[model samples]
Structure formats: C-alpha cells, structure tokens
Target: MFYQAKSTCLYCDHKFTTTKVRMSKTKVLKRDSDFCIHYDGPNPLFYDITICPECGFAFYNSYRKLSDHQRKKLKEAYISKINVMNMVGERTIEEAIHTFKLALLTASIVNERKFITANLSLKLAWLYRMIEDEAEELRFLQNALDDYIYMMAYEDIEQEEVDEDRLIYLIADLNLRLGHYVDARRLFSQLITGKQVSPRYKSLAIDRWQDYKEELEDGD
Candidate 1:
C-alpha cells in the first residue's frame, strides 16, 4: 500500500525519495462527522506531509512555493537551529504527528496562508483523535477553528478550491467540538437559513444541529 516517490526540498533543493500510501489499495471504512477518514489498512493521512532530510522543511502539496526572501529567513530562523531527521520511509502514527508538527512550524515561520495552516491543524487534530488523545485533539481543533475563522474574515475564498459554505459549517462544527455552544448554534443557524448556501452543506448543518439538540435533551 506504500510506494516511494521522489521529492525536491523547497528550501535546499535536495532530491530525496519518500514513502506515500497508495489510495487505490486502501478501502474507506467510514468518516467521522468532522470528515476524518477511517481506512481498512494503512491510513494515507500519515503520509501527506513530506519532510526534507536536509533542511528540515516540511510541506504538503498545497504549500506555496517559497520566495527567495522566505527561503533566506527560513534558513536563518529555522534551519540553523534544528537537527534534520530522516523521515523518508514508512511512518507510524506518532512519526506522522512529528512530521505534521514540523510542517505546522514551517508554515508559521514562512507566514503560510491561513487556509493551508487550518488544514494542517485539522489533520493534526485528526491524528490525535486516532490515538484517543482528547487533549491534543481539542488543542489542534481550536487552532484550526481560529485559522479558519481568520481566513473567512480576511482571506479570499475564490483563490482556493475550498467551498465557502462548507468552510462555514466546519468552523461551526469545530466550535461545537470545542464546547463553544453559543457560537456553534449561531453559525449553524446562519448556514441553515442562508439563502445563498449550498443545499448539501445546509442539509449537513441541519443534521448536526439536530444531533446536538438531541444529545442535549438525552443528557437532561
């Protein structure tokens, strides 16, 4: 289910082979409400972030190409400090978490887009959920929620492939998971009643809102 792929480091231009999961070989078991996929075998999410053995620059496909100034800054601020680890081959869940954390750090150091950082945080949260680490999961979920909210407020959604309505629903769901019930309820209501929202996400918001209400009633 894994194959070696060649990658060039964005900062150092080091060509290296890295392992990736073949999605065709994996079967989808189910997805959580937050859209984390469960697989029958090795999870592909573990291999999504590629880490450079030379410069320690970790990134994914959606990452923007580094400018010359950004590269210089990365070298001075990050590359000079850390010991580069070889994360080239097959990875365990813990190893994946390490690479993801490295990618998040890289994103921050270079001022990567909020959308990309939000995705990295969300995936990191999902990895923590797989390990039943509730504390870490909620922590990253909050990071994702904050980034997504920032993106919605100041960034251009048209530039990215992300659907705005779905993003709103995700923000609302993250609020729910983080125990921010008032914000969750208000955002979910916005999606449920918005005239311009897509039917698919609207339906999803309604379903999740109903589930939350039912859970509250059952608890009482």
Candidate 2:
C-alpha cells in the first residue's frame, strides 16, 4: 500500500518523488482525545511531509508557498548547509522520524506559522509515543503546548483549521498533560460552560475536570 508520488518543492521548484501510504490498507486501532490516530498497519502520519531530495526542502499542507525573504533564509540555512540526499521508496519508523525532524528544522528556519510548528511538534510527540519514547514525547509535547499557547495569544485560528471549541479543548488538554492543573481547570471550565461547544468536547472536559480534582484531593 505504499507508493511514491511526484512532488515539486515550493522553495526550489525542484521536482521529486515522495512515499505515501494508501489509507485503505491501514485499520484504525484507536484515536487519542486530541485526535491522534493509531493505525494497525503502516501509519499514514509517517508519510505526511513531502521532502525534496534536490534542495533539502521539507513541508506539508500547512505551508504551500514561501515569501522571497523566507525562501532566501531557507536556502542559506538549510539548502546550503546540508548535504542533499535523495530519499525514495518506503521508510522505516526511524527514517520517518528523521524526515519529520528535517521538516521541523525547515519550519523553524523559514519562520512558519505557530500553527504549523505546533502541529509538527504534536506529530513528533505522537511518533515518539508510538515507539514508547516517553522522554522525547514529553519534550515535543511541551513544545507543542508552548506553540499552541502562543497561537492562542497572537495568531488567528481559522474556523476551518481549528474551531473555537476544539482550540479550548486542546489548550485544556495540553495544560492537563503539562501538570498545569489550574490552567487546565480554567480552560476546561470554559469549554464545559460554552454554549457552542459540542457534546463530545463538553463531556470530555467534564470528565477530565473531575479527574483532575480527584487527583488533587488524593494528593492532599
């Protein structure tokens, strides 16, 4: 179910082939509260980013084009510094992680939106979680939390990307994971009280809030 598809890099206009997974071949094992999917076969998450072999450019759906300034910086920082190697065919988990790391590095160099970086960090966390790498998972989780917080404060999240209810729920969930109990409680409270929040998120927020309170009581 894995195959290669032609991709043209926006940064360098260099055409290349990238591996992709056919979703029909994969069964969904489960999904996390944050909507991270666990698959029974080759995970599609591994093949999300498109990396250009010729210029060492890496990107995904979030970033399709780059400004002149961003292109110049990416060329100097990434294209000029790294040894461009052609990566084709199927990829192992380690190789997939490496590709994601390259994408993260490129996103940083190009000053991509916080939403993009946050999603990348979250994906890294999910990838590490799949391998049971707790340390790396937590590290990327913290990065994702920080980026999401920044996004909430300074960035406008389009409804199509992340609706208001999902955004609040995500913030609450991140705070819960990070042990920011007060923040989690606050956001969860808001989510539960919000009229526009869906029943799914409201129920989740209610359950998590109760769990947090119970944990605090047990600790005391």
Candidate 3:
C-alpha cells in the first residue's frame, strides 16, 4: 500500500521521495459520525503532509502549487527558521503530528484561507485524538471550530457551492461537542429542515438533534 513518490518542493525546487498510501490497501474500521476515518491498515492520515527535507516547506494536497510571493515567504520564514534536515524519512505518529503543526504554522505565516487553516488544525486534532491525547485534541478542535466560525461569518468561503450542507453539519456537530447546545440546535434544525441538504446528512442531523433534546431534558 506504500509507494515512494517523487516530490519537488514548490519553494526551493528540492526533489525528494515521500511515502504515500494506496487507497486500495486501506480498510475503514469505522467512521465517527463527524466523518473521521478509522483505518484498519496503515492510516493514510499520517502521510498527508509532505515536508521538504531541504527547505522545511511543509504542505498538503491543497497546497501543491504556490505563488511566487508564497514561495518567497516560505523560504524566508520556514526554511531559514527551522532545522529542515531533521524532518526527513519515515514519520512516527508523533512526527506526523509535528509535520502537520509545521504545515499549520506555514499556513498561518502566509495568511492562508480560513478553511485551509481550519482543516489543518482539525487534522492535527484528529491525530492527537488517535493517540488519546485529550488535551491536545480539544485544543486543536477548538481552534478548528473557531476558524470554521470565522470562515462562515467573515470570510467568503467558496464551499458555499461545493459542500455548504456538509459544512453546516460540521459546525452543528462541533458546537454540540463543545457544549454550545443552543447554536448546535439551531444549525441542526437548519440542516434537518433545509430543502437542499443531502438525505444522509439530513438523517444524521435528525438523529443528533433528537439526542441533543434528550440530553437537554436529562440536564433539566
């Protein structure tokens, strides 16, 4: 399931080989209602971020191409600031989390879109969750939820056409987890009653909303 693929750093043009997981080799053990994947084989999540050994420019699939200004910033801020050579080779789960953290830092440095930052943060949270590190998991989850809120409220997110329903469901679910029951109920109600929401998400939202009401009743 693992294969070595050649990657050229967008910032430095440094060529390196990185490991990638073949989808065929992975079996999904389960999925959290929030759509987090639990894999039976080598988890593909660990290998999503590619770190350029020579330049320390870490990125993921969404950031393969870079503008000239972005490249300059990465070279100056990322390459000059870190020990790039230390990140080469196979990554342990801890090392994988490190790479994602670095990617988040770089994303922040470049003023990346809120959606990308939130996604990277969420992935880091998921990685921490995989290791059962509750503190780190909650920390990153909160970061992600905050960014998701900003993206919805202030930023012009393109996902409005792509997966807005899914995004709404995510916000609702995150609110529920973070104990924002009123906001959760509001978003969940929107998803459940909206005409365009997918049947799958609608069904899931209905179930989660019922559970939330029961929890509220129990709290009373």
Candidate 4:
C-alpha cells in the first residue's frame, strides 16, 4: 500500500526517495470535524512530509523553493546542527511526528506563511490525537488556532486561494474543541449570519452549534 516517490529537496536540491501511501488502495473510514481522515490501511497523512537525508530539510509538496537567504539561514540554524536521518522508508507514527516537528522548525526558520504553519500544526495535532496524547493535541491545536487567526487578520486570503468562511469555521471549531465556548459560539454565529458565506459552512456551523447546545442541556 506504499510506494517510493522521487523528490528533490527544496533547500539543497538533493534528489531522494520518499515513501507514500497508495491512496487508491486505501479506504476512508471516517473524517473528523477537524478534517483528520481515518483510513482502513496505512494513513496517507503520515507520509505527507518528506525529509531529505542530505541537508535535513523537511517539507511537503506545497512548499516552494527557498531563497538564498532562507538557504543560508537554514544551513546556519538547522542543517548544520542536526544529523540528517534517512527517513526515505515507510514511516511509523513516531517517525512521522519527528518529521513533522522538523518540518515545523524549518517552516519557522524561513518564515513560511501562516496558513502553511497552521496546516502543519493541525496535522501534528491530528497525529497526537491518533496516539491518544490529549495534552500535545491541545497544544498543537492552540498553535493552529493562533496561526489561523493571524492569517485572517493580516494575510490576503484571496491571493492565497483560501476560503475565508472555511477559515473562520475552522477557527470556530478549534475554539470549541479547546473549550473556548464563548468564542466558539460567537464565531459560529458569525458564520451562520454572514451574507457572503457559503451555505455549506453555514449549515455546518448551525449543526455544530446545535450539537454543542444539546450536549450542554443533556449534561444538565
């Protein structure tokens, strides 16, 4: 259910092979509200980040080629310090987490966009959730929430091709998961009432809000 794919490292231009799950062979079991997908076979999420053994640069398919400054900074701050491990083979959950952490570090070093950071944090949170590590999951969820908020406040959603309503919904859902009920309710309301928002997100917001209220009432 896995195949090796050849990839060129963005930082050092090193050609290497990385393992990937054959999506055609995998079956979707369920998808969480947070968009964590459960697959019947090997999870493709685990193989999303590719680490180059030559320079220790970790990245995903969406990552762009680095500038000279970023390359220099990475060499001084990241590549020179850590011993690059050969992670080209099939990755375990622990190995995937390790690669994701490295990618997060590299993303920070180059000042990668907020959306990308948010996505990486969210995936890390999902990975932690898979291991039943609630503390780490919440921590990364908080990180993702913060990054998403920053993106909305300062970044250009249109240019980034990000759906604004979807981002808002995610922020709201993350707030709910993190127990920020007041903020979650407010955001859910925003999505529900915004005229420009898509009906899909609006319906989703209403469903989540209603379910939350029902849970509260049931508990009481």
Candidate 5:
C-alpha cells in the first residue's frame, strides 16, 4: 500500500500531517476485467494516491507481491540502512533511532509489511523498555504482537512459519522483559507447542520458560 503518507516541505524537509485520498473505479456485472488486481473492475479503474500537499510526497497504498529480485534489492537496502545506522555514534543516537524507524517504515511497505512491522515494533518496544518507558514499551509490544499475528496468518503463502514462530518467541521474551510474567509464559507455551518450529527455537523457549518460572517463584 503506497498511500498513508505524511506531508513534508521539500525545501525544509519538515513533515506534516497525513490525509486520505480516494479512488474511483467502474465494473461490469458479468464480464471479468484485466485491469483490476482483484478482478472486480469491469473497465477502467481510477485509484487515488495519497500525497503530501506540501512536498509532493505521494505514496500509493498497495500490497505488492514480492519477487526474488525485489527481495534481493530489499536485503541490500536493509544492509545499507544498517550500515548507515551504525555510522552514528553516542552523540547521534537519537537521530540514528529516528532514521532506523523510518527505514523500517519503508521496509514495511516492501511486500512484507506485516513481518517488518512486527520486527520493527518489537525492536522499538525493547528499546523503550530499556529506557524505562513502561507505557510506550507496552504499547509497542502490543503492536508487535498484532503485526506478528498478521504475519502468521499468511504463513502458508509466504513461507512465514519460521518467522512467525520466532516472532512469538520474541514477543514472549519482551513480555518477560516488561514483567508481564503471565503473558510471557502463555506466549512461550504457545511457541513451544509448534512442532514445525526449529529445535533451536524450541530450546530457547524452554530455557526462557524455566527462567520465567523461577522468576515467578522468586516473587519478583
């Protein structure tokens, strides 16, 4: 989905609020149309692209299927972004964090929005937890869990089973980090029950589960 854009000033690079855009289309009752992605349109389909009124940052909200070439390009883009993230030191950590999130936003649009969103949100949640931002961490962890669920829903088509399982484990880990012991235990239990999940992952889950049990027993 390309739309859902934040406006920006091209000259000053200041971002603004987001606004909705509409699409109009025509359909025939009986016949199939070649122009429609969903085959619901009979003839010409007009679509709206969400655009920034200020800087002309137009994005079309779409769910594009990933091709192998696109995946490779995405990997390259991600690596480059990580390299860029690492370039900043202690002085620029805040800017680095913003850049990292923006890069993740772009990654979310690249055919695997659900997975990217889950991963990004979880990472941010962990970071927030580290900074003692309990409310923010909880919110982001929930976002991560929701996105992970969405990603899991498409596991069959996208070979996302392993990733989904991993995300579950991550969610459990984060929950534990945030002192949500019951939630972490339940999530870890669910993750460990997945026979299709890798042995390594299952082992990790078991280890975490034991640790969690101990923590609960220790009354902290």
Candidate 6:
C-alpha cells in the first residue's frame, strides 16, 4: 500500500487523504515529457494544490471568476432594488453606496439601458463623495452628467425618460460635495438661471455654489 498524505480539497472544501493504492504512468525516455498519472478510488476533486489568491482556496474560484456573470447580474438586481431607498435610514446609506457602485460596474459590463447607466453613474458619484473619494466622486459625477445630458438631448430615446432637472442638480450637488467648487458653482448658477432644477434643491445648490466660490476665492 502506498502511503497517503492528507490535504484540503481546495475546490470543494472536502477534507480527505489520497487512497493508498495508486498507479503512475511510465516515464517517457524523453526528458520533460508530459507526465500522466492514474488513481484508484474516489478521485480527489481536481482541486489544484495551488491556492486561489482571491478566494484563499487552493482551487476554489477566484472572486472574479466566482462573480463573473451571474454574481454581477445579481449585484445589478440588488442595485435596482435599492434605488428607491432614501438617505436617512440606518442601512440605507450602506445599501445605497454598495448597490450604486455595483450597478456602475455591472452597467459598464452589461450594456444596459441609458438611464441605468446614467443613474448608476450618478449614484456612484454620490457614494464616492459620501466616502471622501473626492477625485473619483467628481469623475463619476461628471460622467453621469455627461450621460444624462447626452441622453436628454439625444440618445436612443423611447426606451425611457426621467426627471433630467433632478439629475442635473444631483450632478451639481456631487460636485459641491467633492470640493470641485468651480465646476459646481458653474452648474448650479446655470441651473438656477434657467430655473431648471426644483426650487428647493436649486436654492440649496445656489447657497452651496456661493459657499464654494467663497472657499475658492479664500483659498486663492
């Protein structure tokens, strides 16, 4: 009987040892030839001995591979559900930020509808601002703004429509939050001049715009 060594099955997490009985292929006279091995009894799940970096299992799927298609779709679905959650609740903020980022990544991969793309971009920007990723926050907000503006003016319409004004201020608010004062001030001023945003938010945006400009000038 051949001696067996115990090891963790990296693929499925089954703990076991190789059976004592084994068969090995004859080594080819040629050196460096591919070696073939045969085993008896329950075949240990292929389970690579090498560890999986992302998942921490020797053969288990990496996070990327585990999430490849279905997990991403699930993330998108979760994000879709949390879209209606307001900002005030205990779990709301966490859920919003998580789903928003997931949606942004998934939307980029899936070629979803324009609003999903637009809204995810907007939500991701806001989430980044909340977490203090200022540069990333502005970059995403600008992207959302571009997506919304392009969609509102033109871009395969008939699929869906939304409150463009709300989106405009949402983007502006993101900029304000991110300390992109010049950009925020410009957008808020334009929206206020056109009365394009809701009165309440527009007033808030204007106030923020003024504050942002003040900070800018003081800093200068």
TM-score of 6: 0.43
RMSD of 2: 2.2
Clashing pairs in 6: 51-58
RMSD of each: 1.1, 2.2, 2.3, 1.1, 19.3, 22.4
lDDT tens digits by residue: candidate 4, 87-162: 9898889999998999899999999999889999999999999999999999999999999999999888898898
Task: Give the clash count for model 6.
Answer: 1
Between prediction 1 and prediction 5, the one with superior lDDT is 1
Q: List the residue pairs that clash in candidate 3.
A: none
lDDT of 2 by residue, 1-220 (tens): 8877888888878877788898888899998866789988888898888878777777876784899999889878888898775566677788788878998999998888898899899998889998999899889989999998899888878833687688788878877887787898789988889888899889988987887779889999
Candidate numbers, best TM-score first, in rank order: 4, 1, 2, 3, 5, 6
Compared with the true structure, what per-residue lDDT tens digits does model 6 show for residues 19-132?
222234223232110011223332121221222122222221112233346445544554334333221212333444554554455445544555657655665554555557
lDDT: worst 10-residue window of model 6: 28-37
Global lDDT scores for all candidate models:
0.93, 0.84, 0.83, 0.91, 0.52, 0.49
Q: Give each model's clash number.
A: 0, 0, 0, 0, 9, 1
The sequence of per-residue lDDT tens digits that candidate 1 reaches over residues 65-171 is 89998988888888999888889888899999999999999999899999999999999999999999999999999999999999998998889978888899999
Minimum summed lDDT over a 10-residue window in model 1 is located at 53-62
The residue-by-residue lDDT of candidate 5 on 1-220, one tens digit each, is 1233354432224465442222343333442110112223221112122233343322333324446665566555543443322211121224423543653555553545676566556656545544577887678777877776666676452453345566677767766765677888888888789778788778889987886678778996
What value of lDDT does candidate 6 attain over all alpha carbons?
0.49
Question: Which has the higher lDDT value, candidate number 2 or candidate number 3?
Answer: 2
Segments of candidate 5 deviating more than 4 angstroms: 1-91, 104-112, 155-164, 175-183, 190-196
Model 2, residue 138: displacement in angstroms? 0.9
TM-score of each: 0.96, 0.90, 0.89, 0.96, 0.48, 0.43
Error at 8, model 2, angstroms: 1.0
TM-score of candidate 2 versus the correct structure, residues matched by position: 0.90
Predicted candidate 3 versus true structure: per-residue lDDT over 1-220, tens digit per residue: 7888888876778898888787888999998756779998788888888888777788876763678887687767777789865555566899989889988998887778788888998889889889999899889888999998999888776743437788889889888877788899899999999998899889999988887779879999
